[model samples]
Target: MTSNTAMIPSFTPSMNPSTKGTDHGVEDGVTGEKLLFFNYHEYSVKNYRLIGENTEDFHEQALIITHFPNFHVPRDSNTFEGTRIVRISRYFKGVGVFVPQFSPYLPGTEPAAIFGDDDTNAKFIVQGEYMGQFFGTSSYSPLSEYLTEKEFREIVEEINVQLRDAYNSWSLINLLLFVLDLLSFWIMSDLIHSLSKRKLDALFNFIDTRNKSLEKRGIKIISPRDSGFLSVCIVSTVKT
Candidate 1:
């Protein structure tokens, strides 16, 4: 299974009420709330594995296997969204996953992208779920700020070994298929980089053109001091 990991008790938007409004989204008759798990919860999910079909729609039927410490739950749970489903793995004893509801929020400017609304909370939950995949169980900690550079490299090496072993187990045909996948990824990355550069160039050029237009209109476009001096001269001349 393709897996990844993230740091838990992850950084969250400040708890100030002013920032709370930015955390929610509403679209398509649905509302989304950010769910952040504190480390001291009575029970926290340790391992979470999500298995789904390679379909464009994620709402299709899927299985989520997880391990919850100090909690006992049934093996199979109810389905969700009338289509998406979940069940606990017999191998892992934990509560069945409950899919969080999310709908994109449009801020009156740019419409939110599909599934972008719940991305933050999704990250927070997934981090607590998959810490073992990236960092070894013994070495992983929510207090990553205490880890030294050498310790961080050791964790990375451990993850790399796991990835290498998985790659080495593939058959020759699968290896070739993997190569094609890498090429496609590279091509897409290059295409995105090129588009980003073009957009940045266009934005800079527009700023430069606007500055020139202001200069032609006798508006100093550089330091605020220059503009202030010109304003003072105008004021003095009017008083004289």
Candidate 2:
């Protein structure tokens, strides 16, 4: 009979995406001063605090993953220790709500140009380049010290697979929506144009009548006091 227990692996590979000519795992032309985006999924939280409330430590723990800096680790909030595995759960929840609609709008089939090599774990808008001194450290930080390199890589691989699937699915859905919208606009254009002329004429008439009423009431249209009398005049016009 075969043993039911499984053996633990000793080593894993790096999950970082390969860049051209550089082993640093970051895209070309990415300077240090750029703004890094991170996605934080919080598990437990306390009461909501309005403005001027003492609410510094609302969440007990959170799982944060670097998003914008892409494969590069950011100096600020670099550590991910003591956080539970909740990425899979979040992914499922997002899929149920059809999160693919938010994928970047681009023409043609080549999403890789925009998404780069690893599209899954690091999809974000590259918000301009950093022109000044770097505010954050450029050194890479391990997700956890406890896990071996292989283990870490494997986990990240799983995450990337999940993310890629969601994004690809979303892109397809978005394409369908775009086609539908185009067809809809084409079908309704003439009907909309015909109705708009009558609507515009009615609007001009309403504005003229309202202006006359305001003039009769001796209410300067821009005055603060005119707001109260404007409502009264509107009601009288409707009654008439």
Candidate 3:
């Protein structure tokens, strides 16, 4: 977090044959706001809104989690209460797809990190300090709740395993296509409904990760009076 943040997370092309320095996760002594990069393009959304037009209530109910302050996105217009979408805390270990719940949705061996001393239901990110914020929370991001290091690790482990399997299986690609396809063929039908809660969640999580990684390089210095101004950036996407 220096005055020039970009200079720190640089990918060197010269003098790299033997020299070394800290990686992108840490800050050199520059001075930017304590950054929690959210590259909206590298990650995908994993939640109910991906399916179709979410109910208006769903918009109000969804939550987003981040490692830093002032970073978030709104839900798509068609989601239900149980839907989820979120980013991982930088402190999370195991950086892959995962599901914390122990059920049919659960998988085994993903990327995860353990943070803090307590062992409550917390998840750690490999990138930043631990703060158990999660998406779709009513009382703020999920990380605000004090998750013990153990509980957080367990949740991250669960998510990483799932993400790893999905990547190995190329399921993230398939699932995105599936969502787009399902949304397309049946989308025009007013009766279209969500395929499964698990599927939706996976999509949200995927998109969020993409956001953090790919979009981190760019930040808009918005006018304070209208912090909500809209700007557009072109991006490629899965074919319909």
Give the candidate number with the greatest TM-score: 3
TM-score of each: 0.16, 0.19, 0.22
lDDT of 1 at 178: 50
Model 3 residue runs over 4 Å out of place are: 1-67, 73-145, 170-240
Ten contiguous residues minimizing lDDT sum, candidate 3 = 103-112
In order, how many clashes per candidate? 0, 2, 63
Residue-by-residue lDDT tens digits, candidate 2, 1-240: 011111111111112122112121222133322121111211112223322434433432211121122111234532212111211112221233332111111110111111222334232222111221011111111222223345434433433343344345346654565466588976644444423234334433544554565445322112111232111111111000
Runs in model 2 with CA error above 4 Å? 1-22, 25-145, 169-240
lDDT of each: 0.24, 0.25, 0.29
What lDDT does model 1 reach? 0.24
Rank the candidate models, highest TM-score first.
3, 2, 1
Q: After superposition, how far is residue 4 of candidate 2 from its true place, in Å?
A: 46
Q: In angstroms, how far off is 54's CA in candidate 3?
A: 49
Which candidate number has the best lDDT? 3
lDDT of 3 by residue, 1-240 (tens): 343211223333121111122233433455432232222211111232412343222232222222233333333422212222223322221232232221111111111111222224233212111123222211122333333345435544444455344444345655665667676785523343333434446644654564455344332221211222121111211111
